[model samples]
Target: MRKLGCKPAVTRHNQPRLSGLRMMARKAPARLVRDHIDPAPLMLANDQIGDCTSVGIANHLRATASLAGYQIDVSTGDAVRFYSESTGYRPANAESDQGGIEVDVLGIAGRDGYHLDHGTYYPLWGTVDPQDRNALALVVAGMGCAYLGVQLAAADQAPGVWDTDRTGDNTPGSWGGHCLLLWDYTGLGDNDLVTLLTWGVRQKATWQWLHSRIMEAHGIIWPQMVLPSGFYPTGPDLDMLKADNAAFLMGNLWQVPVTS
Candidate 1:
């Protein structure tokens, strides 16, 4: 594992915590599971939900995303609405810090060093994860780039698809409350998918559900793979900058299947 050195969020991988693992063993409907042979990605893009956590995660991710010239498409407020399901912009149930948001931010950090996407995470967070929305956020008090709260995701809902390896069945993904980090998108990216880390119990359904919903148009997502903190010298690289160490950055996403 990569020692976070300064980035606290980068500590853990997709591994689950002790208590959390036990909970899954006890609650997950493993016996009721009906296996799928050649699985097809579920078409459930119209049902994305967010907890107060995503608010923080999106804020920091917006910075990293900006570095990759891609946005994470997350928000729960009109000030930075990126989707119809956005917090208050919608007519159905506009709320704040709901969760499940994607975003895009930019940084001309030219001489000003690292600049966070005010458009994507302005009222949100900067210099630190304000409220534990993302892994980095959890380490707000620290100088590193990661934290425990950010490493945790709420928990297992129920596996809606063939997630025998993780979520079981008939559930909305993982259901529980735990911490996570934003590391290891490396593996998922290799599989043409994105990966994140959590200090709490790791649940495959969390990402799986996010994937299914994204494909279903339930929320904003990238058809292309979203990898963890890595290097793409050809593109905007945030991790390389030292002068802008604590500053923020932004990026844009390509090939996004949008309804609008």
Candidate 2:
């Protein structure tokens, strides 16, 4: 059985919303995935503990690095350590294994930094409009991935394409909250609109399912990292994004106008 460990996102008064930024003009691909590197999932100990939040973070960074033409692995043990470091989950004390909040963890990662195999990578993380699919495609295409928190339904227990249920059993959070990493997405018109990583496996779910179940979505960028040759991102301006994140952390609400 897979364990869900993501708590509802902590709301900040002036959370940095990516939709407010001026994004690139190029069209996002109808489908995108970093599977060329064939990165495998580590499960990150989610089978036994509620550390999906940390697992999602580890997986996202691994996928991003793979897309950039190198491999940096996040083992199950590493993820467990991260969960303890981030959420204070202890292996011996199950009571300390309580779930984590996505935004709070992301904020910490951005402020402190995440230690991967290469070194500590400081990420600029922020929320995005969960209701906007076009914006989501654009974000994922550019960043190589995004992190999602969903209210799981009972229907999620059975493995197949996760979709809505008509029997009133698909109510959000009916099962619990789970965190997923969005690494690939098909077009908005497709039934299985996105490919996400959860429980150390790839799962496909409809956009409608995502729209209804998603409580929060976030995007992360590593401005200090450079991509491999031939990979171009159609995302936000790094400079403006940095400014906005700084303002968000400092308790100031500053909106940079989208320039032409």
Candidate with top TM-score is 2
Assess candidate 1 and give its lDDT.
0.25
lDDT (CA) per prediction: 0.25, 0.74
Q: Write the per-residue lDDT of candidate 2 for residues 1-260, one digit (tens) a residue.
A: 78999988678766667765656344557677455555455687899999898888888777777777676767788778767767767787878888887876776667667776557777786677877776677778777677899998987787778888644489889999999977786667637567887887778888888888998888877766555422233244666677767776688332322212
lDDT of 1 by residue, 1-260 (tens): 11111111221121111111111122211121112211111111112433323332333344345434555543244212332223222434544323322221111111121222343232211222222122221221111122223221122333222222443343332232222233222122212222233212222333343333221100111112233422111122222222222233322222322231
Kindly provide the TM-score of model 1 when superposed on the true structure, using C-alpha atoms. Answer: 0.25
> Could you tell me which 10 consecutive residues in candidate 2 have the lowest summed lDDT?
251-260
Taking all chains together, each candidate's TM-score versus the true structure is: 0.25, 0.86
Judge candidate 2 at residue 166 and give its lDDT: 45
